[model samples]
Target: MTTTQLAPISARAQFRPGLTPAGLVTVLLGAALPIIDFFIVNVALPTINADLHASTATLELVVAAYGIAYAVLLVVGGRLGDSFGRRRLFLTGLWLFTLTSLACGLAPTATTLVIARAAQGAASALLLPQVLSIIQATTSGEERSRALGLFGATGGLSTVVGQLAGGALVAADLFGTGWRPIFLVNVPIGLVVLVLARRLPESRAHNPLGVDRLGTVLLAVTLISLLLPLMEGRALGWPAWTIALLVVSPFAAAAFVHVERRMERQGGTPLLPPSVMRLPSVRSGLMVAVPFFAAFGSFMFVYAMTLQEGLHFGPLGAGGALTPMAVAYFTVSMLSSRLVARYGPKVVPVGGAIVVVGMVALLCTTLAAWPQVTILDLAPSMVAIGVGNGLAMTTLFRIVLSHVPTDLAGVGSGVMTTNQQTSLALGVAVLGSLYAGFSESLGTRDAFALVIGVVAVLAAIVTVTARRLPDPRV
Candidate 1:
C-alpha cells in the first residue's frame, strides 16, 4: 500500500487519543529506545577505547557510522514500515535493535563494534519513523501535540541520561561486564518495549509502496561521503583527500535530490517525497533542527572527551557533570506546551540565546580558573543551559511538525529525523575539527572551551532564524 493510498485519517481532523492510552504509552516507550541508543554511547566511548585500544578515528567511526547510516536509511525505513505495516516493522526493528545491542556489547574488536553499531543504527532507522506515523495516523490536534511533546521530552532527556547511565553502568561493571553494560542494558528495555509494541497497534497507509532503491542508494552514498571524512578527518591529520571528499559531497547531495524529485514525479513513492520539503513547518523546523542537533552532538562528544582527557575526569566524573543538565531538560520539556502556547517557539530561541550567554560565561570562568576549576564548579551553567535546551528542543519539534499535513506524516517524520541525525554527525565533525585544530596550541581545556563556546554562538544564530517560524502551535 503506497502512502498516497492511505486514508487512516483525514489531514484536517482533530487529534483524539481516548481509545489509545495503552497504545500511546507503548509507542512512546518504544520511542525512547532509539534516542537512548543515540547518545548512550558518548559516555562509554572512553571505556571502549581503554578496553579495546580503538584509535580516535575508529572511535569516531563507531559513533558516526550509526548516525550516518541511520540518517541515510531512515526514509527508506519509513517507506518499508508504511508498506509492510507499521506495527510489524516496529516490532521487528525492536528485536533487531535488541539483538544488535547485544552484538555491540559483546564485540571484542573495534572493527566488530563499528559493524554492530552500524547495524544498531539501521535498526533504529527502521524503528523510529513508524512512531510519529502511528501517532499522526492514530491521533489528532491536542492529542497529537501532547504526544509529540512527550516524545520530544523523552528524546531530549535520553541524550543526557545516556551519558549518566553510561557512566554508572561502566562504573558498576555489573557481573564484570565493564563498558558492555551500556549496550547490554538495552536488551531488557528493548524486549519490554517490543512485547508491548506488538500489542500497541498496526496501521499503514492504505496502499503503502515498497522501498525506493535509487533514492536510498544515492542518499547513503551522499551521507557517507559527507560524514566519514568529517568524522575521520581530524584524526587522520586533515589529509588533502578529506578536503577533496568534502568538496565532492555537495555534488552527490544534489544528485540525490534530483533523483528523488524524478522518482516522486514518476509516482515511485521516493523515500523522501519532494512534497515533504514544500511544507513550511517541515522546512523551517528543519532549519532549526539541523543546527540544534549539531550543537547537541558537539556538546556530548567534546565534553566527554575533554573531561576525560583534559580535566582528568574518569567516566564517573564526566557523566556526573551531565546530571543536572539532564534533570533540567526533563523538567522543562514537560512544561513546553504551556510555554509554547503562551510565548510560542520565539521563546525557545530567546532562551537559547540566554543559554548561550550562560555557556559563554561558564567558558570564561573555565579560562580564568584554567587548570584549577573542577567539574563541580560547572554544574550551575550545565543546569542553566539545560533549561535553555529544554525550551529550544521541545519548541523546535512542535514548530516543525505543526504544519506537516497528516497524510505526509511518515515522510515528514523521516525527513525531520534524517536532518537531525545527519546534522548531529556533521556537528560532531565540525566541532571536533575545531577542537582538534585548537588543542594543538591552546591546550585541551582552553581549546574545548573555545570550540564549544563558538558552537553555542552559532546555535544562537540558528535560533534567531528558527524564531521566524510561521506557526508555533499545533
Candidate 2:
C-alpha cells in the first residue's frame, strides 16, 4: 500500500511568525481587564453611592463617562496601533490604565472617581484594539482560529466575572475599603500584565495610514450623540437636550460616511474605509453582533435586577447565581474552534437556536416560580444560555474578522468593538427602560418574563441571520 504525502506549507505560511503561548496569554489578559472593568461597577454602584455620598446623577455619570470615552476613542486607538506599533500602544495603554485604576481607587469624592473612570476608559480604548490587531497580524491557520476563540471566551467570561468579583469584594470590604477594592484590584493585575507584555511580538502595518482628524471628530460626535441620550434619557426623564442629541446622531453619522467616502475617492486614507465596510462578512457579522450583544447585555442587567430585587438575593448571592452559566460558557468556548472546524459557520445558527430555547425556558421558569424561585431553579437555563452564547460569540468573532486584511486589522478591531460597546449600551437603555416600565405596571416577575420573551425573539433573529455569514477559511 502506498501512503499519500501531506502537502508542503506555503512560503508565507512558513515565514509568518505566531505568538508564543505566553504572549497569547498576556494579550488575552490585557483583553480581559477592559471588559471586566466595564461590568465590575454594576454590582458596586450602590456601595459607591453610599460610601461617596453620591447623588443618582453623579453615579450615572460614573458609568456613562467611562463607556462614552471608551466607545468614542476605540477607532482612534486602533488607528494608532496600526500607525505606531501594537506592542508600544498596548504598553502605553496598559500603563495609563494602571495609573487610572489607582486614581479611581484613591478618589476622595464622586467627581474625582468619575474623572478617573473616564481616563480609565480612554486607556482601555488604547489597549483593546492592539490585542486583536496583534493576533491578526502574527497568527495564521489553526493558531489564529484558536487565539480568536480564546479572545471571545475571555470577553464573555470577563463580563460575568466582573460582577462576581465586584460583589465578593464589596461584601468582603477588606481593609474597610468598601467599593474601592474593585478599582484597586486592577493595580497589581495591570502591573503583572505590563511585565508579561514585554515579551509580546511587535506588529504594525507596513504602510500605516495617518489619522483623519475631521473623520475622528465626526465619528465621536455620531457615537456620543447616540449613546449619551440612550444611556441617560430614561434616568434624566428624557430631557430636551438628550432628545436633541438623539436627533443629531443620524446627521452626524451621515456626515462621517460622506467624508470617509470622499477621502477614499481622493486616494487618501479614511478613518474607516468604505471598502472595508463593503465586505459581505463584515456587514453580515455586524448584523448578528448588534442584536446578539444587545440581548446579552439586557439579559445580564435584567437578571441581576431580578435576583436582587424580586428574589431578594444579596450581592454575593446574585453574582453566585451566574456560576453555572459562566462555567458552561467557558467550557463550550474552549471547544468552539473544534466545533466550528467540524460544522463551519452553521455552528452560529445552531447556537442561536439553543439560545432561543434557553431564553424561552427562562421565561417559563420566571412565570411559574416567580417569588419562589431559587438559584437552583435558574441554573439549568443559565447553563443553556451560556453554552449557546459561547458557541455563537466565538464563532461570530471569527466570521467577522475572517475577511479583514492583516494590514487593516486595527481598523477592523476598532469598528467591531465600537459596534459591540454601542450595542451593549443600547440594550441596557432600551430593555432596561422597558423592564422598569413593565415592573411599575405588571410587577417584577411578569416584567422579567416579558423581557426574556423579547430576548428569545432576538435570539431567533440571530439564528436566522447567522445563515448569511461566510464560512471561515480552512
Candidate 3:
C-alpha cells in the first residue's frame, strides 16, 4: 500500500506543525555525529593502544563497547522518543554524547577510555534514531525525500570522513594532544549543533505508549547474544561461550518475536510490533539493507587491511585512498532525491547494477595489478562504487520509511537502523573472517578478489529484491 493510503495514527495530530531549515540542519548534524563516531576510531586504534598502554582486549573494548551499547539500546531509544519528546531526547542525548566524548578525550587510562566509550555509545543510542523520526514526522513528499537524501549522504560521508579525519587528527596531534584530538574534535561541533537544536519543533506520539520493559529486556539479550559473539569470536579465538551464545541467539530472537506478537494480541505495545513487519516496504527494504551494509563493512575492513598490511600504506595514506569514493558518493547523494522523484523505486535496482559493475571492476583491477596497485589505480572502481552507494543508500532510506505510520516513526527508524548496524557488524565478522581465511590459503590478492566476488553476488541479490519494492511515486 502507498504511504498516503495507510490509516492515520492518533499521534500525527500532535506532530509539530513546522520545521525550519535551521532545525532540519540541526538534527541532520546530530545524525552525522553518531555515525561518524562509529568509524572514527578505526584508524586511531593503534595510537590509542600505544598512548594508553592498553592490553589487546581493552583495545578491542574501546571499539566493541560503543558498538554493542549503540546497537542494543537503539530500539529502546526510539521508544523513549515516541513516549517522551523527540526534541527533548535529541538535545539530552547530544549533551550526554558531548560530555562522554570529553571524558574519552581526557581519559588517562585504558580502562577509563573504555568506560567513556561505552557511555558515548549509550548517548548515541539515544540521539541517532530521533533524526529519522523527526524528519518522518515533520516533513512530507519532496521535502521528506530531500531530507532523507541528505541524511543518507551524511551517513555515507561520515563513514568515509571518519577514517580520513581520524587519521589526520591523530597525525596532526594539534597542541600535542595526539590521538585525543579524535574524540575532542566532536566538542566544538556538538556545541554548535546544540545551539541550533533549540530551533527544532518538539514532536511526540499523541497517545504515548508506555515502555515495553519485558520486551526491551528480551531484545537486549537477543542482540547481545548475536552481536557479542560475532564481534569478539575472531579475536577471542572462537571461544566456546561465543559459539554457545551464537547458537542461542536465534532462539532468543524467536522468543523476543513471540513476546512482541503476544503483546500485540493482548492490545499492548511491544518493543518491535510485529505488525510493522507485515509492511512490504519495511520487510523488503530491510532485507536489502542487510547485504548492502554487510558488504560495506567487509569492504572497509578488508580494504584497510589490504592497504596497510598488503600494500604497506600508512593510516593517512590508506584513508586518503578512499577520497575518490567519498567524493563520488557525496556528489551522487546530493542529486539522488531528483533521481528517486523521477524514476521511483527503480532507482535501487539500477544503483545495484552500477554497484555490481563497480565491484567487478575493482576485483578485475586487483587481479590485473597485483603487487603494484595504488590509490590512483583503484580510483575508477572506487568512484563507480561510490556513485552506486550514494544512489542505493539514499533511495533505500526513503523507500523503507515510505509508508510508516507517524506514531511509529521512532520505533520504525530504530528497527531499521538496528538492522543496518547488525548487518554491518556481521559483515566485519563474516566477510572479514572469510578474507582472513582466504589470505592464509590463497594469498592476499586472490582473497580480496574472492571477497569482492562474493559481495558482487550479494549486491546482485539486493538488486533482485529491490525489484519488489513499490514505487514511491505511486
Q: Which candidate is the best by TM-score?
A: 1
Alpha-carbon lDDT, every model: 0.76, 0.80, 0.77
Worst 10 residues of 1 by lDDT: 1-10
Worst 10 residues of 3 by lDDT: 1-10
Candidate 3's residue-wise lDDT over 1-474, tens digit each?
001111113445445576678888888889888777877776676567667876434554676677657766777776677678888989999999999999999999988998899899889988887787787778877887888667766776787778789768877879988789889989999999999998888777666666778887777788778766765677568889999999998998888999999999999867667888778889889989889888877776677667666776666777777777878887888788899999999999988889999999999888888888888889999999889888888788788887877756655666676676667666766777677677888988888888899999989998898899877676
Q: What lDDT tens digits, residue by residue, belong to model 1 across residues 163-241?
A: 6877888888888777898898899988888777767656666566668887788888788878778777877777998
Candidate 2 wrongly placed segments (more than 4 Å): 1-25, 49-65, 107-115, 132-160, 195-204, 405-407
RMSD of 2: 6.1
List the candidates' TM-scores in order.
0.88, 0.85, 0.84
Q: Which candidate model has the greater lDDT, 1 or 3?
A: 3
Residue 139's lDDT in candidate 2: 83
The model with the greater lDDT, 1 or 2, is 2
Ordering by TM-score:
1, 2, 3
Model 3, runs deviating above 4 Å: 1-25, 45-67, 106-118, 132-160, 175-178, 195-203, 405-407, 437-446
Instruction: State each model's C-alpha RMSD to the native.
Output: 4.0, 6.1, 4.3
- For model 2, what is the error of residue 179's alpha carbon versus the real structure, in angstroms, after optimal superposition? 2.5
Pairs with backbone N, CA or C atoms under 3 Å apart (clashes), candidate 1: 1-207, 1-208, 2-207, 2-208, 2-209, 6-206, 15-140, 15-141, 16-140
